[model samples]
Target chain A: MKSRKSLGDSEELKEINISPLIDMVFILLIFFIVTTVFVEEPGVEVQKPKAASIKDLEKNSILIAITAKGEIVFGGGQIGIGGIRPTVRRLCAQEKLPVILQVDESAPGALVVRAIDEAKLGKARAVFISANPI
Target chain B: MAIKRNFASSEDMTEINISPLIDMVFILLIFFIVTTVFVEEDGMEVSRPEPSAVQTMEKDSINFELRGTQVLMNGKNIGLGAVRAQVSRLIQGQDLPVIITVGEEASAGLLVRVIDESRLAGAKNVSLAGS
Candidate 1:
């Protein structure tokens, strides 16, 4: 009888209280949810030019990329020059967000100018060119 | 009697299972972790002149012509390294507007670097013009 009682107590003890673990997980989950900003990234990588005047831009702004082939890209897809105005207009409709142009070192200058013109026409709060700190 | 007591105890300890809730929470946590982008983008602002604000070019305004990969001033290739020096030498303690006329074949990177160099040289009102 004593052995059976001991066995029953051990079984009860084996059921570890997991409330603390759930609490920790809940905290972490809430933290991530609160801090998440769903900004679309320009998927392709480009070699950004180095500059001494580069400053930290807004993290929640729109990101557009110009490849070495002069292809205008946004959100992992080639949007072309025509897409800039519409995209910027739609995104900035709710709130005026800055537009950041990530141009490769070898991208053509004409495309950059056109892209800026379109973004300006779309009412971007400001247009910035991404660069590395020299 | 002991078996009856054990059965009664088991019946009395009815707790709601929360394993499913924990699983859902874990999935949400993982999703957020994977989606979070901690990218720190650094950049310089390009202040394009408004189309309605077009005015005659101010005299003594510094002009930089970007052609292919070369920087030019007055039809002479001042080269990339000489941009800051040239702008500062011409600026001479005034808020001289610097206009960059980007050529068709000029690279975007070189143009941005020239703008940055001009800014560093204390040229305040920098603007872009299409070539």
Candidate 2:
């Protein structure tokens, strides 16, 4: 019985404690999960123009995309410039969010201006053009 | 009998101490939660010219035209590299309104670049002419 007690003591000393490691892993996992922001694509991809004055946009704003072919896309559907005003009005009425326009580099200037005009008619608080930082 | 009972109870209390480990984990978790910055996608801010807005041609106003791929200042075709210099020289010591007139067929990218260059040159009131 004395020999068995010594042997058990030695085995206990050799055992590694993994509770701290498990706690560390759990902390890391929760950190990533809390900080991760899910970015939603606008369904249509366009080459964003580069600019020097780009600023971080608000996350909860409405997104309007203009394709290289001058197609206006909103909420995963192709919409006309006329449709922008009403949609923006409704969305802004619900939540006063800024409007962001993601215009393709090759899109016509007139279309972008028209979209801006419609967004203004909708009484958007602010308008932004999406561009990559130079 | 009392000594044997005390030894058996001491052996039973062999579990690892984890209170400090849990405290460290909680501190780390709180640090991460506090330091995390939830930054969203970014964009360049542009404001629409107000309708019924007065069109006042200030003495120090500079006109930048975006036609095709060329950037024109006062009707002279200047490269994009020279825009800042030209705008800075024209503004002198006065706050100038830089008006950008974009052609219908001109790419929006060109317009944005010209606006950025003008802003870089310290033009305070930059406005896009309604097409």
Candidate 3:
């Protein structure tokens, strides 16, 4: 009887408690879901030039791309230099933000300068030319 | 009475002390959630040049001409890889202005690369001339 009682107590102590583990797992899952953010890419792909003075950009800035073929892209749509002013103006009026020009390494220099000029005309708070760090 | 007492004690033992464990897990979860930073899109770093009211041509400026894929430093053809060394050699002791003259048909990428290389070579004031 003594041996049997000891065996029963050991059996109860050996039982695994998994409810707390389940709760922890669920909490971890919720934490990851809440923290995940979707990153959007510019539609066109261009090889950006390398620079030593590059810095990380702010999170809420607008992205503009000039492809190697000299096509201007804003918000995944093709736009001309003339389109830059109005688009930037509307967006900046809502919330003044930095405009990042992702110019292709082989695009025309004139197009890049033109884009910067138009962004200035649109009253963009700041204009940045994107480049990779060497 | 002994059997009844044993049964009651076993039932109490079956109840795991998990409140403190749950509290610790909750704290860890909260810490991870609060410290999490959403990853930003990967891209290059960008800098802004000051806008000038008048495009004044400065003296002692070195000209780099971009025609198609060929890069020219003062009308002499130089490869893209050689640009940094040559620029550093030229701008060693003085902050000579570096001007890049890009043709209308030249690639913008080449121009930016040249500008970056020049800056990396210690050229302080780099400007792009109108095509």
When sorted by lDDT, best at the front, the candidate numbers are: 1, 2, 3
lDDT of candidate 3?
0.73
Candidate 1's fnat? 0.90
Per-residue alpha-carbon lDDT of model 2 for B1-131, expressed as tens digits? 99999888889887757778777776776666665657466677776544433365444468777788988876799979999999899888687678777788788888788878888888877777654
For each candidate, the DockQ is 0.64, 0.36, 0.26
The TM-score ranking, best first, is 1, 2, 3
TM-score (0 to 1) of chain B for each candidate:
0.74, 0.61, 0.55
**Tens-digit per-residue lDDT, A26-54, candidate 1:** 99999999889899999999999899987
For candidate 3, write residues A71-114 as lDDT tens digits: 88987788888898998898789878778888888788877877
Best by TM-score: 1
**Candidate 1: global Cα-lDDT?**
0.90
A40-133: candidate 2 lDDT, tens digit per residue = 3467888989988778898767788999899999878988888999989988896677889998999988788788888978989888899898
* Model 3 interface CAPRI class: acceptable
Off by over 4 Å in 2: A1-41, B1-39, B51-54, B58-60
